[model samples]
Target: MRRTLLLLIGVFLASCQSGKDQKEDVKQEPMRTPEARKEVVYQVFTRLFGNTKTANVPWGTAEQNGVGKFSDFNEKALAEIKDLGVTYIWYTGVPHHALIQDYTAYGISNDDPDVVKGRAGSPYAVKDYYNVNPDLADDPAKRLEEFKALIDRTHAAGMKVLIDIVPNHVARNYEGKTNPNGVEDFGAQDRTHMEYHKDNNFYYIPGSAFAVPNWEGGYQPLGGEKNPLSDSRFKEVPAKWTGNGARSVQPGMNDWYETVKVNYGVRPDGTRDFPDLPEGYEYKGYQAHADFWADKELPNSWDKFRDIAEYWLDMGVDGFRFDMAEMVPVEFWSYMNSAIKLKNPDAFLLAEVYNPDLYRAYIRKGKMDYLYDKVELYDSIKHIVKGYGWTDHIPVVQKGLKDIEHHMLHFLENHDEQRIASPDFAGKAELAKPAMVVSATISTSPTMIYFGQEVGEPGKEQAGFGSPTRTSIFDYIGVPHHQRWMNEGAFDGGQLSAEEKSLRDFYKRLLNFTINSPALMGEYQDLHFFNKELNAKYDHRILTYARWSTGEELLVVTNFDEKKSYQLDLKVPQELLRKWKLSPGKYSLEEQLYGSVKSELLVPAGGAGEFRIELQPLESRIFKLLRP
Candidate 1:
């Protein structure tokens, strides 16, 4: 009799704890206003977006492998992108960067091939902050005007424009030829003899001259092409630190030797030369941060970057995609971002910060609108899609980031990541369906897609200075799948294969629903954990969740298994049923993504709600509950 009583009491306590957890799960604050739409960013590599060239010759020049001009993004193209549910078009590699091609006629000096990554050059190595890349314009001298026209066209198509702002470094031969009046170039007023100074733009090694890295692994500039600038020589009187902070005159082959690191008032001893933020500043808004820095003395590099950002804002650019932001100090971001917010309060400040520890600091104190959620969500999804990991880890990851979930941007493909269709990854774009659904709708943060992600660009070309698997940001090569969508500049999917078209249609439906759903901007509760415990058939390959607002309730489920279909009973915790005020009745469950499927949700008196779901391999569904 005593043993029976103890067992019964333990079971009752367990049920009560489970109910309490479910109640707490749905108590999160909404990410934004109920009426606000989620942002979808489309990152297009500007020079390669419209290039229809089939000649993907290794180390090919712009003429051989035809480059896409800014004119390529015509009204038709912009409209098509907008129709894909993109709210922002990130025109990557727009700024004037160091390239091997000769633009001396336009008063632009040729960058040494030894320092340039490819004939096209790395976009991170900004050569002229005030000018646009000459290669992107039909008329080289009118590059900035062409970019401005592109920005205007993007806005006219109902999408904002985003461009790169590489604050951590610049090209080794940076020359601000088109700088605005009263503005001087970086390092112009530097005290070169000193290694570090608050006023100096770059850190120097007092007694050494810059030397080219020793090419190894058979790697050479332009694949050993004989050019005057490729003679293994670059003239710098006093060697400055390499872009990746390599404090050597001769950086290794793997180091970022082509660019020089920009110093932001931090000494070699790790002491800050700038003023620190006041206590309680992290919880404050951008306006308060800006006010705090208004009367303080800042570094010269800080002032220069602020001017560059403000100049672009004046020219109608909506926001920036800061590169390698974590390497730079958060204090610098607080100062710079606050200034940007002061000018354009609605500016989208997305940063490439990979450190999980710095995520909150960058978003809170640094005032960043979004930080790349690469370290957590993207990695977890990649592992699961590749069939090596379980879906159960996702909820744990989300729980860890619950406080700042809305600030972490999600992406499956970016310029730096391998293509989903590449052999190194899932090897098929279809395999990423479930992952994409979860990533876009799992949080209220923004969703970003690379240029050819929808069409499953494998990025297998061996373009010079870049390997297979990932798209080459350094070479002048045409993106094959993206080019098919370009369809001879028709901006239609006239040449896309049937499979590609289907994949693209899937993306369109998913993205459009995300931007239009109020539930996505509302409270979320994890059904995955609940189902895992209550449903006998629920497995680690499946994930389910609930999102709801005033009049909307969504049950999202995904099957990551590419080989198996599931017929399982998915459960909604008792506390969730109570919160929904759903009392012992059958509800209509309609699919929102494809709109061709429906399921039944049955709630029994004194029990959890049940969803009899049939999920196919690599499939995802967003079901809406009809209360009738």
Candidate 2:
């Protein structure tokens, strides 16, 4: 009787399950991808990073001084950033800057607190790569802890962190001593250690004045209106020092940066008249920091440099944004890459090689994972939008990708370049949302968003080397007043415009799409771009291109013509893409859909209403193939 009852119950349950299963069929959602695939950045100038001072120490002036302590970083503002869904937060000027006796290299102290006019100079002049600039070290070790923690939070929340590092130059503010392992003092000692020489500096051109700072108005020009590099006059008065192989190298062995110009020679015993040591030890430059081979002295400098990098990584550095990485010897990078890989293989090493043309040089060298795609920005402005002529450029864009196997790190704005609102980035008269949106999704390398980029960061001209230089005025432009932007001194406060909010949200949405879309993350999808032919007449304008990743294939078509759409068709891998093309007759890509979709299709300009896919005159789109 029990068996009979069980059989009946089972039959009833099976009948109900069958009925429920027929009701509705659901498709499983695709795996969510990380932000790295279509990354964006929020760049912060450390001096102008946030609102509050690092520590409670008084900096002497509210607007003029640099952020005081290493521990004072703004958190409230960062919280909002977390929501924006950007992948990277790059901090510039974290290490101490260069300084003369006291005054900042430039005297124009305006709205920024981290300027530290009389404090340290700019972050570019790296005094000690290991020492965190005291101004930004709000919580000392805790600050770094929080920094790395921020990366963790970012990654957990879907993001990455990158910090700027200057490898080519040392801050004049370093305080390290001349003895073994050198104890760092900062700014004052920085002046005593940092020097500029033409030749020994470039590695390629050490003391040849090869790197004359193109002192635009923002920076102090090299002395005598002549770069210590350009003019050899400065080399006449070199410092006479004993340690660090100061004199062992040939007179012209080091660059101007390495040789310090001294007022007088000093003896090791504290006497005014110093003696000549191993070689004809003349005071070519003094107080000018220089490095020597392992045979010269202080066999630990290289290790120290490495240690600085390791310290940051261990302290929570997600990645390093190397400053002037091109100038650093390739051998050093080989060591860096090997070591960094051993420490953390995923650690990102983004070199600041602003020139896209120079991309190969840096990539060939080890230790680098990414570099700027400046050419794209230039093309986006001059040809893609301005349409000065090279109207339908597709080939050029394609060739640019030959060197890169994966994606490229693309950007429209950063600390060094104009923000999105800058004239160059303003592109067309209309809001080219489609253009930018498509670019963000389709570009080869990952994307980096400038700090104020999402919200349409405003730019205002301040003094740069006595001339006016424009920068983002987040406080003046669209922003809402908050403590982080106001009295607490955490960040530049401002209200967000409707456009900014919408743009920001749209970007977030786009990221969300990429994260969840199986079509986008596909490795089989290939990248494509529209560049003018090599021998074509007007080669300067128009950068039309596309990238196919995963299931979604992207094509970016821009009418650099500023006013009109430079209409064009695409060249696809017919053999591969044609397999999925519409039939020869009555074939057409109607609206967003075509007659019949296939695994691959080459929509060239024409075929029974087919083959060629027509791009809107001034717009672009990323096509996701729905395999039939």
Query: Taking the tens digit of each residue's C-alpha lDDT, what string does model 1 give over 1-628?
Result: 1122333323322321111111123222334666877899999999999898989999998988989999999999999999998999999999999998888998999889988998899999999999999999999989988999999999999999999999989999999999999999999999999999999999999989999999998998999889987889899979999887778999887888989999988777666777777756777888899999888888999999999999999999999999988777888899899999999999999998776766767777788999999989999999999999999899999988898888899999999898999999999999999999999999888999999999999999989996889889899998999899999999899999999999999999999999999888877899888888877888999999999877889999999999999998888888998888998989999999998999999999987888898999998989999988
lDDT by residue for model 2 (497-573), tens: 45555666655555555444443443332323212332232233344343444445443333333344443344444
Residue 543 lDDT in candidate 2: 45
* Top-scoring candidate (TM-score): 1
lDDT for residue 547 in candidate 2, whole number 0-100: 43
Best by lDDT: 1
The Cα error of candidate 1 at residue 245, in Å, is 0.4
TM-score, candidate number 1: 0.95
Query: What TM-score, to 2 decimals, does candidate 2 have?
Result: 0.60
Q: Tell me the spans in candidate 2 whose CA falls farther than 4 Å from its real position.
A: 1-36, 52-76, 98-120, 137-156, 176-301, 354-358, 375-383, 389-394, 405-407, 424-439, 463-494, 510-546, 554-562, 565-576, 579-619
In model 1, the clashing pairs are: none
